[model samples]
Target: METCSIARIIRLQDLAMYRHKLCSLLFRLLPQLQGFPPGPPLKKLCKDEHVHVALTETKMVGTLPELPQDILMVIFAALEIPDLVRAGSVCSSWHSAYARLCNLGQYKQSQTPCLVYASESDPDNVLCLYSLAEKRSYKLTLPQPPIRSRYLIGSSHGWLVTVDERSEMYLLNPITCEQIALPSVTTIEHVKSIFDEYGDVCKYEISWHTGTRSSRKPPSIFALAELRGRLQWKAFVFPDTSTGSYIVVLIHNPQAQLSFAKAGDDKWTWLPPHYLYEDCIYKDDILYAVNIKGELHAFDLSGPVITMKTIITIPEHYDCDSRYIVQAPWGSLLLVFRIVHDHDLEPQPGASEYWNTSEIKICELDALWTKIKVINCLRDHVLFLGHNRSQCLSVNEFPALKENHSYFTDDNFLWTVGHTNNHRDMGILNLDDNNMEEILSPQLCSNCPAPMWITPDLRKMNLMGSMSQQP
Candidate 1:
C-alpha cells in the first residue's frame, strides 16, 4: 500500500509538470504557425469545446485543458516528420522531453555501441538490439519475407553491410530499416555468373590472377549462398559529408584482394596490390590498410590515378585471431591485437567445428612501427573492436561504458565456417589491469547470429536514404 501511494504521487507530479510545459509551449505555437520569428501577444484567451486559439484586444490568453502525457503523445504522433520538426522548434527544452514522442529525438540518440544479434524465439525478420545504456534487449523487425540466414561482414558509422542467401551485398540501417543494394558479385572483376537451363543464375565462377590476365589460378564454382563466405571478408564505408555520396571498400578473399565502389556505381573497381589484409580504416581523406603480418599501407585516392604507399611493417610474434587498425579519440592511428587461444567445443572427439576462446594480449606500436608499446590504460575512453568498424569512444560521453576497457565480439572464422554457437567468445577486457572483466553466458546468445558491435547512429540514416537516390 505504501509503494502504491508513492507511485501515485510520482504520477501526479509528472502530470502537473507536463501540463505546465505544454501550457508554456502554447505561447510559441502561434508564432510557429505564422512562420515568423516569434513574439506575439495571443491577444485574447478564449475557451472552446476543442483545442483552438483566438485573440481579443484587451488581453490575449492561450488555454489548453490538462491532458495526460500519453494522450499528448498520441496527438503528437499523428503529426508527420515535417510537423514534428516544427513542433520541436517551439522549445529547446522539448528537444528530448519525452523523446520517443519526439521523432527528432532519433537525431539526439546517444552514440552508444549496441549489439545486433538474432533471437532464437523470434521470427527471422526480427532481430534484437542489446543496448549498453539500458542493459536490455529490444526487438527490431527488418523488412523481409524472412531472412533464412544472413551474414554481416561489417559495420561502419551506423550502417551494417549484410549479405543475403543469394550472395548479394547490400547496406542496411538497422535503426531506420532502410536497405540499399550494391553491385552484384557478378560485376566484380574476377567473378562471373553462370546461368542454368532456365536462364537463372545458379553459380559464380571466381578466379585470381598473377602476372598477366591470361595467366591465372583455376576458377572455383560457388553457389549463391556459399559465395559471400568465400568472396567477402570485411567491408568499410566512407560517406561524403558535403555531397552525401559514399564509397564501400571491400577486403575480399583469395589473398585478401581489394575492391571499392561508390554508392551509385554500376560495378566494383579492383584496387592493386592484393595483400593479406586483416583490417582497414579510412581517416583524414586517406585509406589505411593493415595486413596479417602487421604491415600498414596508405592509399591516395584523390587523383585520377590511385596510388598506394607502404607506411611501416612490424614483426609480430603473438598468436591472435585477428588484428584491427583503428583511429584513437585523439586522431592518431593505432594497431590493436587480441591474442586468444581456442578450445574445441565439439561433442564429438575428432570434430573441429565448434571453437571457444581463452586468452587476450592487447598490443600497440609506435609511429615508426619498429617499437612495441604495450598500452596499459585507456584513461576516459572505451574501445570497441570486432566485426564492427574499430572505434575508440570517450567515457565522458558514455557514462555506463567501462573506462579503459575494450568490448569485443566473436570474430572467429572457425565459428563462421559452419553452424555453431560460439557466441560465448565475446566479452569485455580491462586494458588497464589486463584482466578479463566479463564473458557473456552461451545461453543468452545461443539463438543469435555471430554477435557484432554496431554504434547506434540515427543521423546517418538520412544520408543513406539520400545517397541511394543519387543518379
Candidate 2:
C-alpha cells in the first residue's frame, strides 16, 4: 500500500510538470491570450492536496490542453500558404506538424494559381506573386545565381526554367527557394557563338538586328523573333523526376528546332527539326509539338533512342493563327487558338495599334488523336495560357476561381513597341459568355517581365548527381 501511494504521487508530479510546460508554451505562442485568466497562481501544494484537484483547476482555466496536435493539424492544413507559414513559427510542435504535413503533400491541396511578375527596379532579383484567391501580392526573392539577369523560358511543376547570358539553364522554385542547374549552353549541338573570338556572343542582339531587317514579318513579330534567338531557350518542359531520371525537351536556336537531354547527360541530343514550332508539352512520358501548320508531332522519350512520329494534323480551314496545347487535370488534351484581326498597319488617333485577341477557340482531341472537336464551353475547368506554360485547373479544386474561363498573359504579337506597358491585352476570356474582361492593371515598372501563372508546390529536386556551372 505504501509503494502504490508513492508511485501515484510520482505520476502526479510528472503530470504537473508537463501541464506547466505546455501552459508556458501556449502563453508564448498566443500573446492575445495574456489577459485571459492563466489558472490559479502557482503555489507549493500541501502534502494533503490531491492531484485531481490541480488537474480540475487547470481544466477549468487553461485552453491549451483542449486543442490537441491532431486537431491543430486539421486547422493548419486548411490555412493558405502565407497563414500556414505564420502558424509554424508559433511553436516547435506546430512547426514539426507543418513539416510532416508538407512531406505528406497536404499543402498542395490548398494551393491556387498565382500570377508571378518581376519588377524592373528590384535590385535583389525579387519576383512578385499575386494570389487570386486572397487578392494579395507577395514579393519573393529567388536564390542564387541571380535570376533577374536570366531569361525565363518555361515554367512547369512549380519550377521556372531560366537561361543565363551564357546560355546555361537553371530550374528555380520561387516558393521553396530551391534551384537546379541543368546542362551547360555549349552542350547544345547547334549552339555556336556568332562572334567567333568573343567567347559567347549575345544572341538577343543578333536576333533583334535580324528582325529589324525582315520584310514579311510574322504577326507576333517581336515575340516570335525574340523566341527564335540562339541564346534564348525558346520553350522547355520538365518531366517527373521521381523515377531517378527525367528528360528536358527544349525548342531553341534561330530556327526554333527541338532538342532534348536526360537529367545527368553532359550534352543535348538533337531531334528531327520542326521549324516555326509554336509550343510543346509533355503528356504521359511523351513529348508533343505543334508547328505553324497546326501539325502535332509526338516523341517517345521512354526509349534509349527517341523516335518522333507525326500524330495529328489540324485542318487548314480551322485557321490556327496562334496555338497552345494544354493537358487538363483529368488527363485530356486541349488545343487553344487565338484568332486576331489584322486591321490597318498604321494606328489612328485615340486607338490601340497592336493586334489584340479578337476571339479564342478551344478544341478537344480524342484519345486516339484522330479527330478534333470544337468545345464552346469548358464546364468546370479554367485554363491559364502564357509564354511560360499553359495549364488547366478544375473549378472544383478552387471554388473561388470562375469556371469555363481562360486567363491569358502577353504571348506572341500581343507585346508591341507601342503596347509595351499596356495590361489591357491580357485578360480573362469567358468561354461560356464569349466575353473578355481585364484582370490585372499595368505595373509602374515598364520593363517588368510578362506575368505568368504559377502553381505553388514544395517538392524538392534530386540534384545530387547533377552538374552545375558557376555564373
Candidate 3:
C-alpha cells in the first residue's frame, strides 16, 4: 500500500508542475484562485508539451563540442600517417589531427614498408610513390623533364629501377628525388659468339622455321655512374682486349650466350662470355642462372665458385618457357610463363568469330621443384604473385604498361591492361569459385598503362628475397 501511494504522488506532482505556469497566469489575470500556493503549483505545471518540443530540436543538430587540441592530437596520432593527413581538410577541429600525423620518428625503424611507383599513359606521365604503411602518396619529381622511359625493372629499398625504350637504365629514389645512371646494354656479345661458334655468322637469314639468323656485330655495353645523387653516363667498349677479359659461350640459339667481365678495381662486374641462352634472376643471397637445357645453377655472393648441386633440371616435354620466377607466400618459389598456343588451332577464315586461348603456369621451387598449373586467362598474359603485387614485370617488354597492374587480396581477382581484343580499356578475371567474371571495363588513365610490379612491405620483401643486392 505504501509503495503504491508513493508512486501515485510522484505522478501527480509531475502533472501539477507541468500545469503551474499556465495556471498561475490564468489566476493572476483573472483575479481568481489567487489564494493558491505559487511554488507547489508551479512544480506541478512542469510537465508541459513545450519541453518535449525544445528537447527534440536540440538533438537535430549534431553538435559535438570541440575537444581539446591535446586530446585530438592523441587520437590522431594512433591513425596511420596518411589517414591523419586526409582528415586535416575536414574542419578546424581536424587541424590538430594533421599536426600529429607527421610524427616522422615513429616510422624510422620500420623501413617504410614498400614504396610503390605509379604512372599511366598520360602525356606528362606523372610518376608517384606511395608508402604502403604510411598510405601517403609522394609525386616523384624527375631530375629533369620526364624521359620516354616507360618500363620499371625493379626496386630496392626506396630506389626505383627503370629502363627506357632504347634500353637506357636509371635508378631513382622517388622519395628523395635522387637519380642514378645505370649501365645500358643494347646487345650481348655472347649472343653473337654463339652464332660465331656455330658458323652461322656468315650471310644468312633469320628464319622462324629453323631459328636461323645472319651474322651480326657484337652488342654495345655502357658503364653506369651515380654522382652527387645525380645520374651521369659513360661508354666503354666491352670485350676489353687488354688485361680485363670476359668470355662468351652459347648452347641454345648460338646467338644468346653468357659473358663474364673481370672485376678491375670497379664494383660492377659481369661474367663473360656472357651467355645469351641462360636467363638469370637474383633473390636472397644467391643468383639463379638457368640454361636453355632446363638446368638450374646457383651462384653464391659469399663464395668464390658457383654451387655444384643441381638445384632443378626441368624436363623439356613439360614446357620450360617460364620467363619469370618469384618466391611465393611461404619458402617456395613461383615460376611464371605462358604455355605455347597449340599450333593446331587454325583460324576460321572469313568468319567473324574470335578465339581466346592462353595457358599460364606456376611452378613451386623447393627441393623437388613442384609444378602447379595455376590459372588460364585470355589474351596476352602477365602474372604477379605476392602481397600488394608491387615489383617489376617479369619481362620489361611492354613500355606503356610498365606500372599498370593492381592486385587485390581475393583469389583469381586478375586485373591487367589489354587482356582483351578491345584496345580502349582493360579486363578482370574473377575466378574465385571457378566461375570467371570477365569484366571488360574502361580505365581511368588516358594511355592504357600496363600493370608494373608491386613492392611489398619489408617482411614480405624478405620473403621475396629483396633484402640483398649485387654491389
Candidate 4:
C-alpha cells in the first residue's frame, strides 16, 4: 500500500506542474485575460483534463481591445449626422471624438440635404426629417418659439425663420434648440397701432393698401387675402455671421415693401419701397428680389444706409402667377416662374378649385446683370421649391439623389387641397424632359404644412434671448 501511494503522489505532482505552466502560457499570450477567473488548484483539477483544455481555449479567444481614437474618428467622420450622433453614445472616447469633429466642422462635409416635413402626429411642434440617402425619417421637436401659432417663412443655414400670429419673428436652429428673436412687429413701418379705451395698445392693423376703396366692402378683403391669394412675408439671412454681424430682410404686406434689420437693431428700418416684390434671396452677401413684373433688384447691405439697384428684367410672359429666386450651389442665381391658367374659373362636377400649374420656367442670370437666358436643363442639379424657401442642390455630392429634377410643394394657389391628394400640383418635376411625377405618397392629414428642404449645418450662431427680452 505504501508503494502504491508514493506512485500516485508523484503522478499528481506532475499534473499540477503541467496545469500551472499552461495557465502561465495563456496569461503571457493574452494580456487582456488578466482579470479572468482563476482556475481551481492543480490538485483539485488533476482529475479533469477536459476542464483544463476548455479554460485554455477560452482565454486564447479573448476579445480584442477597443479601436484607437484616431482610427475611430476616421470611421465616424464618414457617417451621416444621425448615425454619427448614435455612435457617440457608445462610449466616452467616441463622444469626445464626435465633439471634436463638430467643433472642427468635419461633419458638415458629410451632410446631404434632407426634406423637412411637419409631423402628422405632432404637426405643431414636431418635424420629420427625411433622409433621401437612408430612406428614413427622424422626428425632431422644437424647443422654443411656440410652433403652434408660428409660420415657417424661411429656412437657411440650418436655421428656420418663423413668424407668429402677433408678427413676432424668431430664428431657431432645430438641431441645437437655439433661438434668437428679431426686431418687434411694432417696429415695422406699415403696422398701425389700434389703442383701447384706456389708451393702451390693444390691437394692431396692417395698412396693406393705402389708396381709396370702392363703395362695396370688397368681398371681405381679409378673408380673400388669407384664403384665395395674398402676399406672404419672406425673409433672407446673410450667409456670413462669423463676426456677429448679420442682416435680415423682410418683404412686408401685399405691397411687398422691403424692410431690414441688423444684428443689434431694435426696430426694422424700411427701405425705399419697391413695386410688387414677389420673392427675395441672399447670395454672396447681397439680397436679390423679384417683383410681379419679373424685374430683379439687388440690395446692398454693406453700408449703414441700404441701397437697391435694378439688375435685370425677366422676358414678358402671359398668365404669370408667382416667382421664386434661388441661389444654385455653384453660386449661380436662378428665377423660377410659375405660370397659371384660369380657363374654367367655375368648378364643375367633382372638380376642385385649384389653379393648374400650366408651366414652369427657369432662367439664369449673368453676374453683371446684363443678360438673362432661359434654361431648360439643370445639369447635375436638383431644385427644391416651396412657400417656405426655395433651394438648389448639386447631385454630385449626394449620389443617391436623382439629378436634374425640381421637387415642389404646395403654394397659395394649390393650398386648397392637401399635398398628398394634390398629385397634379406637388411632386418632382423632371427638368430634363419637363415631366412631373409624384415623389412622396405620404398619408398626411389635411391642413398639414408643406415640406421644405433644409441643409443641415452645425456651425454655432450668436443667439439672443427670447422675443420678450433682449440679449
Model 3 CA deviation exceeding 4 Å by range = 1-125, 128-150, 155-159, 164-167, 184-268, 272-284, 289-293, 304-310, 316-321, 340-357, 366-450, 456-471
| Per-residue C-alpha lDDT of model 4 across residues 258-360, encoded as one tens digit per residue | 7877777899987665756767876445778888887888877766667888888777654567788887777778888876663344668887555555567
Question: Cα miss at 352, model 4 (Å)?
Answer: 3.9
The predictions' CA RMSDs to the true structure, in order, are 11.4, 11.8, 20.3, 15.4
| Model 4: CA > 4 A from native | 1-65, 145-148, 195-201, 209-232, 241-244, 329-331, 341-351, 356-358, 413-424, 463-471
Per-residue accuracy of model 3 over 1-471 as CA lDDT, tens digit each: 354345334434553344333322322322122233444333322221111100111121122234456544544444433333333433455554443433332222223233243335433445544444333444434544363233343343444445444334455544334555543332322211123466643222211111234345443322221110111111111122232221111122233333232322222333323233334444443555555566666655435654434477665534633334454333455554433342222446753322222334445555466444343331232334321222223223322221223222111111121121222211222222222222212243222122222332111112112223211
lDDT ranking of the models: 1, 2, 4, 3
lDDT of 2 by residue, 366-407 (tens): 988899888888889898876667878888878768999888
Evaluation by TM-score, superior candidate among 2 and 3: 2
What is the lDDT, from 0 to 100, of the residue 325 in candidate 4?
88
Which of the two, 2 or 3, has more lDDT?
A: 2
How many pairs in model 1 have backbone atoms within 3 A of each other, for residues 3 or more apart or on separate chains, i.e. clashes?
Answer: 6
Clashes of 4: 0
Q: Considering every candidate listed, which one attains the maximal lDDT? A: 1
Candidate 1, residue 238: lDDT: 70
Ranking by TM-score: 1, 2, 4, 3
TM-score of each: 0.73, 0.73, 0.44, 0.72
Sliding window of 10 residues with minimal summed lDDT for model 3: 226-235
State the weakest 10-residue window (summed lDDT) of model 4: 49-58
Q: Could you tell me how far off, in angstroms, the CA of residue 143 lies in candidate 3 after the best superposition?
A: 4.1
